[model samples]
Target: MQERLNIVPFVSVDHMMKLVLATGVERFLIELAAYIEEDFRRWECFDKTPRIASHSAEGVIELMPTSDGEAYGFKYVNGHPKNTRFGRQTVTAFGVLADVGNGYPILLTEMTILTALRTAAMSAVAAKYLAPKGARTMAMIGNGAQSEFQAIAFKAILGVDKLRLYDIDPSATARCQKNLAGMGFEITACSSSQEAVEGAEIVTTVTADKQYATILTDNMVGPGIHINAVGGDCPGKTELHRDILLRSDIFVEYPPQTRIEGEIQQLDPDHPVTELWKVITGQVPGRSGGRQITLFDSVGFAIEDFSALRYVRDRLKETGLYEELDLLADPDEPRDLFGMILRAAKPTPVAATVGAL
Candidate 1:
């Protein structure tokens, strides 16, 4: 065992892809959801706080952090929807999992892909409790980076494989369909959001625009339907109209944060909302009636990211999907860090003869 104090494991984008491929996408989602569920069960044990964010005219950058008494984890993520216009991903992230006892990071990994996976898994976990019994088809309103992962997670968890896809840009829908080809989905590319939700048991609105846009209106949603409102995860940005929010029983990860970032931002600050952890812990009911509309106001939370970090750390040993990194400083003397650094400096070699210029 490499017991170097400064050696932390790093999983780059390539290793993350290899790990996901080796684990299989659906299986990975299932396993990741299990980890999320486990953490939610013990939700009160975590030191929770809303993510720290910095906003600008163009986009927002955020730091999500949390600790479960033993392990500390945080993710640095940025969202700039306009990046897609310039051939860059709208969201990119990397995270670290550290030992709470000594504040030493044990793992660092790229979370751009992991965030997508964890967000999908969190949505699926919420839907499993709140969605109607035996729900099948889903209306995916936003065919962007998060659409396919959401579809696969629902498929792996709740057996939802039928997708009615739509996006303002038809090319994005085409790309989404093409990416998810042969994934055992009965796909229908619709021109309008209304057409997409015509027969959907679950309607997911995941548009990437960084503004208040009603991707789903009051009439677009129906009774007994579950709405996974994934976009609108920031201040001044939302996806659903106010009327739809009025008719739905909203479930959120953190109310203080969601009220400012999620679709419920349209509702009153004191509007009643149930915490997802309470529902997961059986302290509160999820879906009460057949005609009740359930809305998961998913503004990605730190606990979910922590769970994703934990899941990836466990998988590293089995798949060998991480590289060791010298990230710590271990001096011969506990208090001699500076001496260790100076001693390791390159010896002053014979100065190269300066060419007479």
Candidate 2:
């Protein structure tokens, strides 16, 4: 009998590029948002754990793993804020998808570009639930690699027409504006964080600096604004004032993980917050009042990545793209895994003793 080996598929950035090109970024975002929402609705069914982290003087490396009984997935991501100086991105990542039944991987992919896409989709999804209805103006603080994605997601999902941009680096702001020009977005470059945040319906902070940066103080934020805290995703890294979290009704993707990585890390351990899934599943109220402030503490959860991967997988199906690799061991004799190796060894000509011959 032949062994039915479920082999893993190797998906590269080129495959991901095909996926993105086939589905289009906007459609992919919508589909990814739906997948993430569905996953959140079934949150109790999955096995969850905190990511493993390795820290260094320059940056940090992280591995986030999760399983849904049938499938397992993990992402290897690094945060090196100083990498930009070396002409590299602040964050780079890759991930894998596996079958839990046999402990065999199904796919491996470069997650740098995918992470940006999923993060933006996740932010948009959170804002869709927490933000006020018909919110059109958004202030993007700390413009960087993620700024354009956030802007595009907001534009596609929430119909945001105006953007007030701010960044510590003037070049970053210029890049953001240049990237978004002629995209039908009303762009306003602001001199200060307060100016960028002033009169905005939604405030998104996706800074790249690895510091406890208070980009937005309480005075800068106004009532009925939805704060998408994107950049403050790692420990000791934050953008909003602690008072902002205390005052606003905070929502997170995963509380246990977020408590350590999100902007809420600055708050008390018992600081009241609602899981975003609860709102999606109708277990909790999303927006209680129009004037009440809301904060979506986005730490880039694994489930969102899972959803994005699934979306990319489907997109790849139509384009006939992606290279398939043999990552799983498939021996003709499943029980004799050692036998396959023994068979491949070159047979040495046995030299008989002259007397024996």
RMSD values for the candidates in order, in angstroms, are 5.2, 5.9
Candidate 1: tens digits of C-alpha lDDT, residues 12-102: 9999999999999999999999999999999989998899999887788999999999999999999887897899988999999999999
lDDT tens readout by residue for model 2, 80-108: 98898899988999998777997877678
TM-score for each candidate, following the candidate numbering = 0.96, 0.92
**What is candidate 2's CA lDDT for residue 22?**
76
Off by over 4 Å in 1: 346-357
Which pairs in model 2 have colliding backbones? none
Backbone clashes in each candidate structure, one number apiece?
1, 0
Point out the worst 10-residue segment of candidate 1 by lDDT. Answer: 348-357
C-alpha lDDT of residue 204 in model 2: 94
Every candidate's lDDT: 0.92, 0.84
